[model samples]
Target chain A: MSCLGERLTALVDGELGHEERDRALAHLAGCARCRAEADELRQIKGRLRGLSRLPASDGADDLPTDDFLTRLRSLAEPAAPAAPDDASGTRPAHPGTLGGQSTRPMRQPVRGAGPGRPRDNRPAGRAVASAGSGALRRHQRRYLVVGAATLFLGLGAASYAAGGRQEAPAVTPAFDRFAVEHALTSGDTPMTDPLTDPVNQIQTSPGP
Target chain B: MTRYTGTGRARRRALVAGGLAGALAFAGTVTGDAGPARGVRSDPGAVGLLRAAADAARRVPYEGRRFLTTWNRGRSATAEVAVTHRPGEGVRYRASSGAEGYRPDSAADESAGIVAATLGLLARNYSVSRVADARACGRAAHVVEARRPGGGTAGRFWIDSETGLMLYRELIDATGRRVVATGFTEIDLDVPAAGPRITLRPAPPARGADRPDPDMVDAQAAALAPWGERLDGARLARLRSEGWPIPKDLPGRLTLYDARSDGATVHLSYSDGLAAVSVFVQRGSLDEARLPGWQKTVRRGRTVYRREALRRWAISSGNGYVSTVLTDVPQSTAEAVALDLPRGGVPFWTRLARGARRLGSAANPFG
Candidate 1:
């Protein structure tokens, strides 16, 4: 009946056995810092649940950085464990676990007597979380920008091709080329005499 | 005195009996002759005299100053003539006044040429059948009457019996009216060189003031030479080879034929068939505005806008086809014997008219 800080968090989430739950409740009653830590973790979890249910509005002006950080801390926290299976002789994993998709026993946040001690470790952890969120946001923005640019380019190309087809049909090249050839050849031997006799003779005569 | 009177009565009776017998013999001779007895057939000497006179008229070139008196519809018109002929060199001067003068003004030179050609034919074919003693211009002359072999119009000649010179000549029409009559008031043939001083007058100015177009006449003639014959199979084949489409039956009597070059293309035709019209294309434009009895009409083609003159023509241009009734003819029988021509075979008439117009404009030395 060891009542650790981790077991207390598990007991609150209904993951602990009856004996373990009783033991965690007794320890919580004696240690004030652990109780405070448990209370803060519950508040973060409630805020995260509220964020997940928040409706997307037309404007983003009201969303603050503090609210986003609160939601992130809740999602990043470890979840409660489940009970052991006696038939398989193996312990069941916890529910609502973090990154690895594994269901093992839950981990808890550190408890300290002074606020200064927790604050000292909070900056480093916050920096790492902020950096990860920033990377993800930047990747999402790049994907959105690329998609919009591709859509605009596709629309422009389609319009240009349609306009070309709607315009005048292209003429055959052979006809224009032959017309130029005939004009050039006939220029040298323009009919000068109004009389038809000489032109008729030339037309009728066989080539020499 | 009583005896003398009785003798005169007996003498008169004897003279009357003799004269009656002579008259009877002359009547017998006239009745024995055939075809216009005792007229043209009775005199061979007169025929010989006319033939000689006609020959002499054409051979001798002389300058004459005379007067012309014309009677039309019982009205008389007079004109003075001053004509000089220089055998081969052509007529140098001719001047006339009055209505007769105007008739010869535009066609003076052409008429002179026709007169010369007629005289030449007469000179070669003159024959006389009768001769008689007569008086002309108050001078004693030998009158001769001639009959042509084909029974054409007769010719009468009055020659100076003393000098063998012709004094008067008459060319009778088929209707017995004298179509042409020429007489010398004071004829002196083969006279001495110094007899009378003949004064030379200045020639009249040309009728048309415009310059003559010789180049147009030549060019038109060359262009029209191809169309001078009928559009038969051979000619049609030739024209087809030249890329011209000729209709099968172009109905018309060709009245005019002309081909000449005078700095332009000129052609004229008058026909009386389906489209009785005259077509004149000069320098590629229709130029027949002055053809007689023709009315102008518009005609369209692929690339040409033609204005033609339509008219009913009586004369045809071929060698065997009869002309229509639009022209004057002696009889329908004569017209039946006349020739029929194809649509394009009437160039001579046009050529003559064009030449006359061109020559009439200028006093060309060569012409």
Candidate 2:
């Protein structure tokens, strides 16, 4: 069972069959990442539904109050309206669903925001980034110390390997003994094999 | 009336001719009748020359430039050596020392070890014959080829006419290819004698004269081991009785003549009188480190390392006992001897030695 990216949204919208809904729910319960995304979508859907209600009192719970303010601001502000379906009393379409799979999901508005609008995401984005940077700053020295030691060891090893190449270790065939042995067997005098390298050039006198 | 004397002399001459013809017929008949009694042997002329060549090789004194050529596995190599010799004493060889070729200055113990072999041993399986005559080392030499009884030539010898010494020798394979050939290129006849032009070159130093040959050492080590106590053959038999599976023969006519164990290595020497092969077995797997330039082969469902080194072909394999066969014979013989060697039932000390060697190598920091 691979991830059903759009099917999970379909299940939440009561668009899946009984069997498919049960399987998607079971998968969501087992996978924390899918479960978290599903939970976020549920919250967004509940807030949108709350906006369709008549009104909420001052002592009401956070959802109704948050939904009222968000809807009122979108209407009263000098910005484009998010969706025509929202005013026409039809359910807003869903934009995206859970990820990690290819899908042609239902196109819809997200958080009453219009499609392809240039929104200022920097103000909220900077807040999360500052908190992440503070935590990372605490361990910066440890990462540097470990990286320096690794680099030093690697350089030392490389030099040591390069130094071994000046004199290549080669296996030299012993010839003097072989020549002598062949001579002994052949019935000539047995100095048949030669020595290695410069020693092989050493001249010798004839037998007495 | 005067012509009677002349006619009588002519009749007497005719009688003498008839008597000579009758005697020749009688001799021919007697020789033909006695022919079967002498018994026939194949290639007598070549066989006799080979024996004479062996004698002359040991007794003659000469200085020459000799060339040795070796062929194996479709590859061949030749080396030229300047040689000086004193019969019954020793032989000295000097070669060019350069990267252009491989040659060495060496002194051989010219004893009756392996070279001066007689035809009597080879005659067991080969028929010696004077197949042809050839010129070598600026002298006329008779070509004596040793042909197998069934077919094919095993070896050839070119003996000089004047000195009876072998001017050239070739070891032939079963496929009619020459495996080894060594002969002088140029020769000088008079040396080591009391004469005006008999000046001999001085011998090389004796600093390292007795360098050990690994092949011969292994063979001698096995031959000299004492085994039998009462039965006079029980030392190895005792091991055999202890459930060892050492074999007595290989695929061909090769027979195991000597077997010994020096705690680690089991040495066995096989010979068919003409060819000698040595098998060395030690408890361990094949050493991959020692096999850099060696060729790898798979035979009889086992991996083998084969190479022609130092004029001898060797094939090695190992599982419990690392068996290596070294011989101047063909590579097939070496491989056959190695593959047919007895396996398993390796002694405890051998295993221990193998383990210790590995541990030692592992402990070496430099490696």
Candidate 3:
């Protein structure tokens, strides 16, 4: 394998046989620019881990910056073995450069593949950010709706309870009137001797 | 001769003066007036006569044996009553006859006892109105009607004009039915000072009895059971907590003591004022019995109900449950207490049957 190819394979496996590994390490040790490049890759990996733990986006605004990196990685990986130099030349020197004007075009290929991959299938970091943003927007809408409903319910319950209390006076007067009318109109006679009523002989008569 | 003639003239003058004095004395005695009396001989008003007769009857103590014959279609039922009056102890009586042979020793007889007792109580409280007068029994009788103050059944008395005796009495039910009638066929006034004889014996002490059986004492309570159970401690506690005053006393309270066994079950109760105790045994059916002049009263709300009132205050038994509020209490209070009583807790069919039996055997003194 070429020297860069051997070094890339070793990096993927995280291992190298000792003598060749020593020679490759010595080349890296002397090369400040390569060391800087390796450092950038390490930073990229760290950023990917952080993105993986991001809340899934539920709305558009919460999409993560790492989404662009994912598209760049996908595009660069396909051409990486054939033209390693060309792929390396396209990469930004620093992670912050991914958000600048030069890296914008790198987002195009993945966007174009959107039809086959579906928006959420792109990569774990980007999908999660999209899911989280969408969820946050939905939560805001729900809070507004719930707050309005609770206020209306509270007002209704208060009115209903008040109405029940108010009715007591209105109802009691009618009952008083009824009682008075009954007392006045009912022709109640004092109970008399049953024997006085000749018709009631059957009732008054002593039974054998 | 001259001296003798002067003496004769003197004697004649004395005679004339004595005759004038005697005439004045006679006039005074006849007019019931030492001074000149006027209009003392006029006839009294019908109302006045009635008042007088009522007063006289109140003062007299008399008793008699009464036989009442009820004829419906071709059938006739006869009941015999022996009544007695004491000066302060009140009237007491016992009634017996062959017509109600089915209830040999039934509460029916107690009905007469109650009627007689009520009459005696009425005698103490009666005041004949000077406004009402009516003819009854072919005599110019005074008509007096006494009504309960709050509203309840009233009694009317027709007193004889000449004798000041009670010739007839009647009880007017709430439905305006003359449900009970009683009158004298033959009355003896100035009945020999000897009180009238009574043949009634105190009901034999019930079997194994030292005092009246508790069940017998509260038979009305037992009959009211299941319904009475609703007035348990929990409900009473609720009432108390609700600021409803439980009535501890009321005027002219009448209590019914009853015990009935429907072959399988026994019921007993002691009722006073609006409160009644009840005990029930064995399941029973409930059917409404026909009461004379009874009218159905419907009250609506959380509990929809139809009740029949014998009088305004006396509710008829229905659906194995017999209930009533003591008429003496406020209607609202009575209704509250009644509502608190358990609903349909009574075995309606059985209680209804018992009620019918009670009414059937009731000895109506007015009758």
Chain B TM-score, model 1, reads 0.36
- Model 2, native contacts kept: 0.08
Ranking by DockQ: 2, 3, 1
Q: lDDT of model 2 at residue A81? A: 43
lDDT of 1 by residue, B139-218 (tens): 78887665553465456767867655576665454456543344554443443333232222222321122312213322
The residue-by-residue lDDT of candidate 1 on A36-102, one tens digit each, is: 7767766766675566447563223223333343345345432322222231111112223221122
For candidate 3 chain B, which ten residues in a row score worst on lDDT?
B219-228
lDDT of each: 0.35, 0.51, 0.37
Docking class of 1: incorrect
Where is the poorest 10-residue window by lDDT in model 1 chain A? A183-192
lDDT (Cα, tens digit) per residue for candidate 2, span B1-367:
6699899989999999999999998887775532332233457777677667666765777888777666778877666767655654444444554211111112223223333333344555566678768887778988887766667777777789999987887777778888867778788877854344223333323223232332232212111101111121466576555424456656565555555443434455555445656565444445466556667877777676666653554445433445556665667777766666665453444444444455456678986
Clash count, one per candidate: 38, 25, 68
Q: Give candidate 1's error at residue B35 in angstroms.
A: 16
Estimate the overall C-alpha local distance difference test score of candidate 2.
0.51
Q: Per-candidate TM vs. native? A: 0.27, 0.45, 0.27
